[model samples]
Target: MRRLGPSDYRDMPWKNGGGVTRELLKLPHPSEPARFLARLSIASVAASGPFSVFPGIERTLLVLEGAGMALTLGGAPEVVLDRRSPPFVFPGEAETSCRLLEGPVRDFNLMVDRALVEASLEVVHLAPGGTRTVPGTGSVLLHGVEGRASLSGTPLAGEETLWLEAPGPLVLRSDEGARVIVIHLTRRESSSSGT
Candidate 1:
């Protein structure tokens, strides 16, 4: 198991050089975005415009700060997302753009090669004293979005995150109001584990 502290994250330019992204964690430590199998990052979106598309890749975006923005996705209705909103996106869809609803907002982004993985993401808001299982085999990233929380018997403060690498079952609980974002990464084929 591995833990990614805030200081461990590194910043880099977007694939299209439109903005900047802080990479929190990634597999095989890709030097470039196209070479990555799975990645977790964050960015501060202050300008309104379109985002570069990544074919055969799945992505999720979580607003972390500010009033958030509105999105118009291809074949989907307009949606508004703020700090409390869930992730929303259509990986390969075209015509997706953002219009700031309020002001600049910080966001958490996760992307994975569709051919390499089938992942799931969920946000669990646990009130003081509750437990949730963190599975083994697959990858898991826990982010404390609000209040204080404890995971795998360790405490996690707000803005703190923990990344586990194929670790065994784990537990997350809290003694105060806490919002935890959980990311699950499952390999598409067991034979490709070495990749």
Candidate 2:
């Protein structure tokens, strides 16, 4: 497992050029083909606008800070989202737009090519010394939201992320009031039904 902090994150323009996002992690590092194969980021949205479309990607968005916003996804009914809400999942190709409910907001985003990966996200709260273990045979990301934690004795403070590849043993220790988002990623098994 590798502990990555804010200092490690990179700033880049949003896909639509409407704003910017701080990239948290990307599978296979940078400059790889199918860059969106599995990626995570935090985006700051200050204004309402259309979302950039990625034809083959699927994503989930979770409100991380501020009052949140209302999302009009494709032709679906408007939905209000905030930090307390569960992560919203949808196709990256959907015609999505957001209108801030109050002021600027921050969000956690996870994207992956549906053909290559199966991913899951969960938010959990922990107390001092509390430990969480991730199983092997896939990748998992522990994204800190509030308070502090440690991964295999390595400290991960607020807003930091821990990226782990296939391994047998892993543990995350948490402090009081520590809140985190765990993302589990696994390669999709080959199938014959498609043919």
Candidate 3:
């Protein structure tokens, strides 16, 4: 397990130039935004605008702060998203954009190369003894977007993220008033290996 600080994350522009993204981590350190095996970042939706699309890259977004925003994906109906919203996009979608419903807001982003990988992310409210064991292959990232938590017995504060290499399982839990958003990233199993 490794801890990553928000102050250490890298920032870059979107391919379409709509907005900027603060890249947290990628398969290869310092990998370009347009090309990465798996990428994590945070975007500040300071203005109302359209979301830039990246074909073949599956995306999952969550509102980090502020009220929320309305999202339109391809021809699908617009959906209102806030700090409590979950991952909503899959691969092969046409267009995705957002318009601020109540001023500016912050959002978390996760994109992966679908052909070579798959991922799962969620925000769980943990009480005492509330623990989650995330399983993965290759690697996985656990970001504490909210309260304080621990991974494999190590403490993590808000905005701190952890990268776990290939292993059996990962543990997450909080003590006292800590609750965290757990993100689990993993490579997809090959069909040839047999389920």
Report the CA-based lDDT of candidate 1 relative to the real structure: 0.78
Model 1: CA > 4 A from native: 13-19, 29-34, 190-195
What is candidate 2's lDDT per residue for 1-195, written digit by digit as tens?
688888989999876666689999887512346555788999998788888887778899999999999999888999999989999988998889998999989999999877778889888777876888756558878898999877677777888898878866667787665888888888777522331
Poorly placed runs, candidate 3 (over 4 Å): 13-18, 29-34, 136-138, 189-195
The number of the candidate with the highest TM-score is 2
Best by lDDT: 2
Could you give the candidate ranking by TM-score, starting with the highest? Answer: 2, 1, 3
* lDDT tens per residue, model 3, 1-195: 677896789988866566678888877412345477778889877778878766778888888888999988778898998876777665535677788988878888888777666677777677766777766556667777767788777887888888777756777787754556566665566622533
Candidate 2, residue 131: lDDT: 85
Candidate 2: the clashing residue pairs are none
lDDT of 2 at 24: 92
Off by over 4 Å in 2: 15-17, 28-35, 191-195
Write candidate 1's Cα lDDT for 77-137 as tens digits: 8788997787874684466788888878888888887777787878888878877787766
